[model samples]
Target: MTNALVIGASGGIGTALAAALEGQGRAVTRLSRADGLDLRDPDATGRALDALDGPFERILLATGILAPSGRSPEKSLARIDAAAMAEVLAVNTIGTALVLRALPRLLARDGAGKVGVLTARVGSIGDNRLGGWHAYRASKAAANMLIRGAAIELARSHKGVTCVALHPGTVATDFTAGYPAHAKHGPEQAARALLDVLDGLGPDESGGFFDYAGRPVPW
Candidate 1:
């Protein structure tokens, strides 16, 4: 049986992805802040993940926050807040790095092992036509770099391991509740789309960023 681990299993997309994986007959291990696996605490995150023995074929780090509590994505440079930006980075960038750093030993060493870190199109510097959401955008951009760097290093030792960043597009989850005007996919739809992209990925495409539709997103 295929084994998978989902780090942010409580959120809408995360929950849907976990369920979808299970539905496909993959045994999935889920961890989340609700389960006391707070990504903000690296030691705790390490311990929690260490408890699991792997050879997991797939690991998805689907945790991210658009804004800190009592805050929103900045609409202008004047709206930027250092504290809020820090919070955004804590969850989106730093949290992702922590989870990714734990991967080498957890993934299948002899065969295909896929790791997908959920990022956003806004994170793409070359694709950012409209400017706004400074913190969230910047944090995800940092995450993309980290994913790429980690993928390169992992390939040197684990040739079968593939790590890539994924953009889920606009999803109709509470995460996007603040911007209802944008078209969004339901969590289930987004989950399926993302999994399809992951399923299609070959080692040759590792370390790249792609959208739900499997199109490469410019950095």
Candidate 2:
């Protein structure tokens, strides 16, 4: 039986991704803040995954934080609050690192699985034509690096497991609620695309970044 675990599974993208994975006949496990598996807490995350009873065939870290109370994308660099920046980094970058750190134990040593994380196009340093969202951009950039580094290490030790970072485009979610209507995709559409990319992943294709359409995203 193929079991899939989805962290941050309560949000629009996460919930949609979980539903899609379930529809594909994989046993799905949903971890969310409401479920008490806070990604920001490494110990809590490790414990939650360990409690799943078996190794997951696929693990998706879909957690992310964009804006905080009293903070908006409209704010300039000088106005960027340290608290909000730290909060975003903790969830977006550090949280992912924690998950990767726990993977050696959470995954089967036999290695026949994949791990994915939802990154954003904005995280692409080469694609950053317009400069704004300093904290979010930096946090996601760090996430991309972590994903790549983890993928390389996993490839060396766990030959059957593929790890890749994905850009889900601008999805119409609470995280992107501030975005204009023309700049967003429906949750279902984005989720479907992400699943497609994941389904096609192989060990040889690991440590790469791709967009929602499964095309290679330039680093």
Candidate 3:
């Protein structure tokens, strides 16, 4: 059976992905801040990941935040809040970095393991059309760069481990509750799509960014 780890498992897409993995008869380990695996706390995050036994077939870092309390995405440069941007990067970019730093040992060194960092299409500098979410977008862009760099290093150090950033589309979760007019997929659907995309990826596709449909997203 495939062994899988789902970080941020308390969130909508994360919860659905965990369920889907379990439903497929895979052994699943779920981690979340609610369960004390807070990624924002590096010490806690490191300890939790360090305790996990090896060679998971798949690992998903599904944590991200649009904005912090009392703040919203900047519509213009004038609306940028330094504190809020820092908070977004803490949870979205730096938090994922902590997990990425711990992933090499937890993955199958035999070149059979895959790791995915959830990112956003809006993070794509070449694909940005209606740019408004400055902080969130910037955090995701940085996270994508981190994933790409990690993938390159892991390829040399861990052989066949494929690390890529994924976009789950506009998921019908609290994450998208602010934009009711946008097209969205239910968490279950989005989770399944992401898994299917993962199923099709190989080491050759490492360090790339792709959307829920497995289509490449411009970086």
Candidate 4:
């Protein structure tokens, strides 16, 4: 049976994605902070990944943080708090980096394996119009860069691995509970759409960013 792994399996999008993958009859393995896979802790993250037996056909990381708890994303340069920014970057960018280090071996080296790194259009430097949420935006942008770089290197070593960034759109989750107006999609719908997007990608499309509609997001 084909196997898949989701790194942020406890989060809103992560749970839905796992269920969807299972519905497709794929053997799914899950890891998250709730299951002792804290991406923020490198050693813990490394240990969790080390336990996994891989050659997975698909690997997705739904990990991210919009901002620290009890605080909103900064709307202006004057409002950017150093500590809050650090926390955002820690979860959204740096933690993912640690997880990424193990991915080269976890995925199929010969068969065409697909990787989806959850990111956002807000992370797109070319799509930025409002220019707020400095830290969250910057962290995601960096994550995109990381994925792009990974795609380039993986194409060389793991020729069949297609790695790219994904934007799930405005899903109604705890993360967006505050902005009720933008809560247009349920997590399940978003997950299915993202999976479809992943299904359509090829090596030529790797290192690109795409939205749930399977359209490329300007980088």
Per-prediction TM-score, please? 0.97, 0.93, 0.97, 0.98
The window of 10 residues in a row where model 4 has the poorest summed lDDT is: 33-42
**Which candidate order results from sorting by TM-score in descending order?**
4, 1, 3, 2
Candidate 4 residue-wise lDDT, 1-219, digit = tens: 799999889889999999999999999999988677876787888888899999899899998888898999999999999999999998999987987888888987788999999999999999999999999999999999999999999999888788999999989888788887774799999999999999999999999999999999998
1-219: candidate 3 lDDT, tens digit per residue = 889999999999999999988988999999887667876688888888887886799898898888996566899988988999899999999998999998878887775898988999999999998978999999999999999999999999887888999999999998788888998889999999999998899999999999999999999
lDDT of 4: 0.91
- Look at candidate 4 and tell me the lDDT of residue 75: 92
The residue-level lDDT of candidate 3 at 157 comes to: 84
Error of 2 at 62 (Å): 0.9
lDDT for residue 123 in candidate 2, whole number 0-100: 88
**Which residue pairs in candidate 4 have backbone atoms (N, alpha carbon, C) closer than 3 angstroms, thus clashing?**
none
lDDT of 1 at 141: 99
Alpha carbon deviation, residue 99, candidate 3 (Å)? 0.5
lDDT of each: 0.91, 0.84, 0.89, 0.91
Q: How badly does each model clash, as a count of residue pairs?
A: 0, 0, 1, 0
Backbone clashes in model 4: 0
